[model samples]
Target: MRKFQDYRDSVHFYGRIWTAAAILMLLLAPAAICVRYNAWPAASAVLKGLLGVAPIFWTTGIIEVLTYAPMLGTGGTYLGFVTGNLSALKVPCALNAMSGAKVEADSEEGEVVSTIAIATSSIVTTVIIAIGVLLLNRLTPVLENPVLDPAFDNILPALFGALGVVYIAKNPKIAAAPMLFMAALFLLVPGLSGAVGVLVPVGALIAIGVSRVLYKKGVI
Candidate 1:
């Protein structure tokens, strides 16, 4: 218990430090650019721009936190959020690691596993990005090849599809409702594809509701 508490405290301490640093670094780049160009926008203009999109971002961020935090745990959540790209990369990686390790995400073992997974992922990603930058000229044609465009576009779907197959197989009953609903919704509306992040929590809630009904009926 003492060790677990210490771990939690340490995670919170460093997580806050890194999160603050990331925010400061993000602000600094724009500030430096503004100072260099002497092109500071009026406060009202900034507010106007933010007004159009800030709410959507805030909604998505909040939804993502609620939806992903349970599976990510504290340390993993902090690292994943700071690193960004949670939906596409960090979330799937951490979840897969926990699943592979057979650890419940709410447990101490899961926290440790998640942190290691996310940290490893962050390091590997940075290394790859650095290498990619160095070889970008050489890789550009291959990366931009029309033949690979479809593969690039479906990367996220493929990642989730693989993970979903594993989890859905474990709980087909619980997965059925959300899977059917989402499949139909996407097949019909299609344009909501851009809003998958927001829809994730909605699907989770629908699954929860369906599970509750099934449980009450002693179906599963």
Candidate 2:
């Protein structure tokens, strides 16, 4: 018990330090850019731009914290949020790693696996992105080629399709309602497709509600 407590304390201590440092570096970059280029926009204009997206971003951030924290554990949460791209990359990478390791989320082994997976994914993504940027001149035409357009457009669907199959197989009861709801919603109101980020929490809430009702009735 003492050793476990020590590990937990150390994780929180270092996680806090790294999270603060990451935030400081993020703020410093924009500050440095504004100072060097004298490119500061009007305060009101900046506020207006922020207002346009702040609600959705803030809501999603809160929802992500609630939904992912239990699965990610402390160390993973700190590093994942710092690295960003949670939905598109970090979360999926962590989940795959944990699944491969046969560890349940929230367990000690799960915490370690999640942290390692997210950190590795962050490093790999950074390296790949850096290389892509460096080679953009040569790669742009190939990336933009018509032949690759459909594959590129379907990447997210393909990824989610595979993931959904695995997860639904494991928890079909919990997955059923939300999957049907989201599909019907998109089908009925195609315009809502563009606001998928904002709708994530809506789907989450629906799933939670369904799960709670099922649990109360001993259905799941």
Candidate 3:
């Protein structure tokens, strides 16, 4: 217990320091760009931009924290959030790693595995992105080719489809209701497709509720 408490304390301490530094660097970059280019937007214009996206971004950030923290553990949460791209990359990578390692998330072993997975993912992603940028001229035509556009467009669905099959196979009782609900929702209101981010919490809530009911009924 003491060891775990100490680990948590250490994580909180260093996490705060690193997170603060990252925020500072992010803010500084734009400020430096504005200063160097003599192109600072008006305060009102900045406010307008913030107003337009802040609500959605803030909501998504809060939802991600709630949704991912348990699966990621403290160290993983700290590093993953700092690195960004949680849904598209880090979260899935950590989950897959934990699954393969047969570690229950939120356990000590899970924390270690998740952290390792996220760290490796972040490093690999950075290297790949760097290489892609360096080869942008040569790769642009291939990447932007119309013949390959459909593959690019379906990448997210393809990724989640494979992941969904794995997880659903493991916990079909818990997954079934939410999957059906989301599928029905999209079919009924195709227009909401653009707002999937906002719907994440809704699906989570539905799944939780369904799972709770199933548990009470001893169905799963």
- Cα error of candidate 2 at position 194, Å: 2.9
Q: Candidate 2 overall Cα lDDT vs. reference?
A: 0.88
lDDT of 1 at 1: 48
All candidates: CA RMSD (Å): 1.8, 1.9, 1.7
Model 1 global lDDT (CA atoms, 0 to 1): 0.92
TM-score of 3: 0.93
Which candidate achieves the best lDDT against the true structure?
1
lDDT of 3 by residue, 1-220 (tens): 4686688789889989999999999999999999999999999999999999988788888988988888788989999998889987898999999999999897888888999999999999999999999999999999899999999899789989999999999889999888999999999999988677678778889889999999999998
Query: lDDT of each model, Cα atoms only?
Result: 0.92, 0.88, 0.90
Model 2 earns a TM-score of: 0.91
Candidate 1: give the clashing pairs.
none
TM-score to native of every candidate shown: 0.91, 0.91, 0.93
Candidate 3 overall Cα lDDT vs. reference? Answer: 0.90
